[model samples]
Target: MSLIIIGSVAFDAIETPFGKTDKIVGGAATYASLAASYFCKNVKIVGVVGEDFHQNDIDTLNQHGIDTTGLQIKAGEKSFFWSGKYHNDMNSRDTLVTELNVLADFDPILPESYQDCEYLMLGNLAPQTQQTVIKRLKNRPKLIVLDTMNFWMDVALNDLLETLKLVDVLTINDEEARQLSGEYSLVKAAKKILTLGPKYLIIKKGEHGALLFHEDQVFSTPALPLAEVFDPTGAGDTFAGGFIGYLAKVGTINFNNMKNAIVFGSALASFCVEKFGTERIINLTEEEIAARVKEFVKLSSFNIA
Candidate 1:
């Protein structure tokens, strides 16, 4: 089954305690597509970039077996650019710059070939844009997962809620979950959010871990502890990618499988924070991923009699 990803594919300038970069290829779709490529075969991305975006970067995605046929390159315009600096904790960040050149008027145009994918990931974007993609699909995907931020909830609550109704799963951080559901307790928030429509909710807690809530059941996955976290950008998107990628590979949609997917996603996201942007994830070997996943099993496994 093919998986379709829709979000921004653009440029970013990042700064952290470790170091800084002028500009790198970084976006919600970029990270998600790269992370998903390792688990699923037919990964197609639908997003907009600018002519300034290097063809080599596009080729890099192709190297990973990701289909870029649906990526639109806007002639003469500049790709969206963001600059941010992370605090010493690495969990909080401040935005220094945001240029929405191409993204300002983004209109996702899905190629006919991408219309039938079994899995769809709507990465962080305007709620209207995410909704547009779902509406454009001739047939609903077997699973639809959405990732959104507090920004959208603050500006477009109605549209975001409307889009949530069309999705099967929703992924958001702890803070956004509270804001969306108006509940301090995540369990209560999940219950309130579930009434809006999605059958599942994943609350990403960054370095702490991720929690998956479905019906009355809950699964918690811990983040791998490391000597250092060089950068935190794109880690959340990477987690989302791995979560859906594993599900797509196994072709199952059950709570048990989703629990495993959360572990896989956390493992992949652990790699993401080891370096800046997508540097750590780009050349990861299967062996490395397997070993990392083993680490996760060791970190959380226990038998209670």
Candidate 2:
């Protein structure tokens, strides 16, 4: 079984109360592919970059068993770039610059080798682009997870809604959940959004951890309280990476497997915020990750009897 990730691959410049970085390799697919490599070796990545994008980064991912055969490198153009300044809380930020560059008119075309993937993760992108990928797949994946932001909801609600219908799981932050459902309470919001199509809803609350809702059942996982959060740019995508990676490793999507996947995802995300961009997740080890998941189990464990 293989996992396929679809999202942007670009450079980012970030500043926070803690510190700053000049320009780093960062994007939805970049972090997702790195984090997922920990659990599963064969990961196919689909995205558009430009001639200016570093080939070394692509080489690194390929060496780690990530297939970039589907990665589009547009010649003679600059890659997409984003620069933002984070607030003291580390949860919110202001976008100072966003250059669409080659991504402005990106139309992802899956390579022939990418068509057989079993797990499809549609990272935050144009809903129509995501739909195009789904259409190209010869067989429906065991599970299709989608990650989207409020930006798309604001600009393309109809297409976003259509994409949601094709997916089994939808992951979004707290504000996006509220805005999508028009409900202040998360419980009510999840309920309302469930009606929108996805069987499972994952609400990512950065520093606050994440909530998983399916039917009448709900589970909450706490985020590790780190001494410092260097960058939170791609943590969400990293979470999705771990989530789908674990499922692909286990070869199932039952609730019990999903429960473990959530813990795995949270553990990966904890390491993500510890460094700038995808730095920490890139060199993470299985032993270290298992230790963190053990910590999470202890943190949330209790005897109510």
Candidate 3:
């Protein structure tokens, strides 16, 4: 099964208590594709990057067996760039810079081969752009997972709502969920949001882990307690990647399978924060991932009489 991921492929400059970086390859699609590649080999990315984007980064993606056919390279334009500094708690951050550059006018053009994708992941992008990709597809993907943030809710609520009706799942942070539904209670928010369209809602709570809501059922997966978090950049995108990748690999969407997918996603995201940018996730081994998953099981498992 092939998974299509659409979002920005850009540069990022990050600062944390441990250290800082000048500029590194980072973006929603970049992290998502890398994380997804671990579970699904047939991962295709659709994003645009300026000439400033490096060939080595592209090669990194290729090494993981990801298809870059839809990655557009613009000659004169600059790639999107974002710079941010994380607070000591590693839970909040201040945006230092955001240069939309090529991303400002991004128009996703799905390659012909991508038309038959069975799994679609619309990473954080403009709601209109996300909808465009959906409309362009010759056949609706078996599963469509959408990730968004408070920024869209604040600036483009109407557009976001319109696109919501077309997706199968929605992934957002706790705060974003509350804002989108105008309900402080997550259970209530999930119920209201489900009425908007997506049957599944994943409310990400950062260090607290994630919650999966579908119909009348709810599953909570706790975050792996790390000794330290180096940088939280791209963790959420990595989570989304691991999630959809697992589902694609298993070829099932039931609640039991989704619970396992959440664990896989959390395991991958735990590795993402151990090192700056995508360093840790890039070289992750199957054995390492398996060990991390075991830890998650131990953290959340208990026998019931």
TM-score of each: 0.99, 0.98, 0.99
Best by lDDT: 3
How close is each model in CA RMSD to the real structure?
0.6, 0.9, 0.5
Model 2 residue runs over 4 Å out of place are: none
For candidate 1, the 10 contiguous residues with the lowest summed lDDT are 204-213
Q: What global local distance difference test value does model 1 have?
A: 0.94
Q: Roughly what TM-score does model 1 have, to 2 decimal places?
A: 0.99
Mind giving the per-residue lDDT tens digits that candidate 3 earns over 90-123?
A: 9989999999999999999899989879999999
Flag regions of model 1 displaced more than 4 Å.
none
lDDT, each prediction: 0.94, 0.91, 0.97
The true-structure Cα RMSD of candidate 1 reads 0.6
State the lDDT at 269 in candidate 3: 98
